[model samples]
Target: MEATLKNLWSTVELVAVAAHSDVVEQWDGQTLTRAFHWAQYCQHLFHRFHDNPTIRRVMEKQLQLVNESVSVVFPEHTAVSFSDLSRCQHLLLVGLLHNTKLPVSLLRILFDTSSPVNKEQAGYRNVTGLCSSMIECKSACKVLSPLVEVSDVGADAEVQGVLLMERLEALLSQSREPFLDSVLQGCEGAAEHFCLVIAAALLTRKTAAAQTTLEDFLLDWLLHKHSLLQHMCYTLPASLLTDLAKRHVKFREAYCNVLKKWASDMEYSISDGEWFQASTNPTVSFQKLTEHFRSLSEASPSLWEHVENQLNALKVSDGDFDVRGLSVWGDLLSEIHK
Candidate 1:
């Protein structure tokens, strides 16, 4: 048993090195297949030797090495590269990472690494472009797409989606501050990519199940846990919100609820003068907030009344006197009424 375990561990190490090699030629169908086989074998060994600590410890160490290698190599492959071969390799690496059940920390690294600084840059273009192309290809739409297949493991779109969410939940439970900071610091598309991935995952579920999952994920995990609603309201692009609304009736309702919560929060902030102190230029903040409200109202007329009510009730005052003279609230209110 010891000899067999040593041989298996050596093979796993070799496969890990080859998978992460700088030589793009080292990555191909064969290399990917070997990775899957090694991962499966390690899983099998761990389970089969459930009573044997010696074997389990060795296997665990090997798996940790594999995860570490992936963490180091992923950023290199995901870097701005238009080469189809490099893209293909990157996609394959993603498959292996998922297959191995990547830890939440490594998954966070993947999210941070792929997140685009802006829509025009390579990171944003790569993620969105890759997703679009994968959909067009009609690949299974697994979290990473069909460029690499996991059908042998019996993981369909729904299962993959759930797994992705589980990892996200784990990450959120650990700390949301860093995650939010990543998004707020110009990594907004990371949030959008997450939405795109989840939407794609929902494509395979029956309507009822999909609706329930989307609502719980959006409300429970995103809105309540991470305070993503604020980012959706002010930072993230409207197109992502529009796409999600179009995806499902439940999504639209959930989004409106998010907007309601945001409005409530904003109202409190305004009433308490926190809104003006939120930034150096309260005028810019007010303009963006109202503009977002306008877009949402146009997209979903049902929200117009709620939006109008919020805008109409926008009154800012300091202690005894109205702060309208000290701030641009009056001018902003006039623009809104127009």
Candidate 2:
């Protein structure tokens, strides 16, 4: 298994390069068949071990790397390659539909069936473009098109919000346990990513239903408050929500409310024991704490200050603030002082 894993990753790297390189469309028929076969086999392994962190991480990383490399041109490349666009499209489709199992509804939304789109056209066009491309020429588009209901999607914000939320729930439920496993791993990375994903999904519509959905989701996040603070105590996440709030005031307040609780918990968790601790490692090193904060602060200039000012006023006004818990699990304050 280990040797196969090694060669498998090597093959993945080579396949990614081919999927992205200008040379792809020119590959001999034999080479093309082998590449597709390998990718398909890998997809099978991915599904078989969907619950295995080791397998999921490797597969997700490879697909991410492939997409990034294919979509972006390196500085070294004298010119960009769009010729392999079809091949890249094919692999990406198989990866998402077969490998990732991304919800079909959203994919359809990203690609409008009334008019088909290619990747280049989609990127330049925004969601308008993204919703237009189909796939892999394996006729996944045919399998997928019936799922879209694009013709039914209209300018109904409430309905759009409803549809979007349904898709979001599908996405969330797909790997809920796996995602929670990562969340419980002592880092805010997964929860922070989840927040961003939700924010993007919710903000696209302008409807009362959309507003209610956002409110509900934010409230639900209280369950993951500790996870939120792991990334929130710094800047980007806070700043991001602040910016998002300009369009909806509740977003700002609801987000700050969670931070306030995290701060309150931090004030007590050091001596209170483990009721609130989320990490499997109950202990946290100051170095990891500082490093995490530093990365968040650097994500945006002065973002830390803006978020801190708002949250500090909310959590520290009682004069009970403490830094000790921040170094430990479930808390988010102490790392700043040291």
Candidate 3:
């Protein structure tokens, strides 16, 4: 096993060097194919002999080799062709997601302002590819699964949660609209798992200071920007929702805070007429918000008080809000009363 591992490591190193060398010429597809083939084999070995310290360390070393090669293949501020970007995407998917270890350094590379993957046209394709790869990689699910498991909840879990949140924030921070849209779409299928992971991680935060930063990011990026609440309300299992609320005060508070912000924003939009002006169908938009709120309330009964409080505050401030000729506010008030 040791000999086999050593040979695989050598092959990976040789492939990395070959990829860098082929940068000036037409990239050898066989080189990439060989790289992936070896990587898949290594993934198998790592999983099977994960208990073996030697195999694990060697695998980490192999992954590091691949990670370093990425920077060489796609240098900073360089114009990368679609083919190169596509190849790099596959390399990243294999190096980052396939491994047991979190490749923080590789993420740093990808998020670097000058990294070719962050370039306008190429960045979109690269980001989309990476996000798509993430959705397809069952290993990523396995890696993140423990973070949400009730049995696995602990200090270590909290640390992992914080780490994951930090990395996700970094990724989102570097992303723009269409690229961001691609990410949100990729996340749709795994939305429940993503929400649970975030919830679990938020609950594990040890300090108010730490929790606040993550909460704001979740609200700004995930919940508000990506419609994470919609996903959570529609997809997250009811039992898990109850479990999360029952498990930690922080989780419930964070969730309520998100709802409060949405209500506050909606109230402002309605008051200023921006909500109606921005929407082709203000009534439909109002109805959707009301329905989402209803679903959210039903999914987590603990949040009902917070929701009601916010709605009442909005009602009091607006005094029978009307959008043009529509009685949307009255409709919302009626729905809440029911």
Residue 76, model 1, lDDT: 36
| lDDT (10s digit) by residue, model 3, range 166-284 | 65555434322223344345455776665656655655535666456655555455545435765564455544554555454545555556444444444335455433323222122
User: After aligning candidate 3 to the native by TM-score, how far in Å is the CA of 229 from where it should be?
Assistant: 8.2
lDDT of 2: 0.44
Write down the TM-score of every candidate.
Answer: 0.42, 0.32, 0.35
Highest TM-score against the true fold, candidate? 1
Better of 1 and 3 by TM-score: 1
Q: Residue 291 of candidate 3: its Cα lDDT?
A: 58
Rank list by lDDT: 3, 1, 2
Q: Tens digits of per-residue lDDT for model 1 on 261-328?
A: 44334322545554432332212244455555556656665555654554445533422224443334
Each model's lDDT comes to: 0.44, 0.44, 0.47
Q: Give residue 51's lDDT in candidate 1 (0 to 100).
A: 45
- For candidate 3, the TM-score is 0.35
Off by over 4 Å in 3: 1-248, 251-254, 260-284, 299-302, 320-330
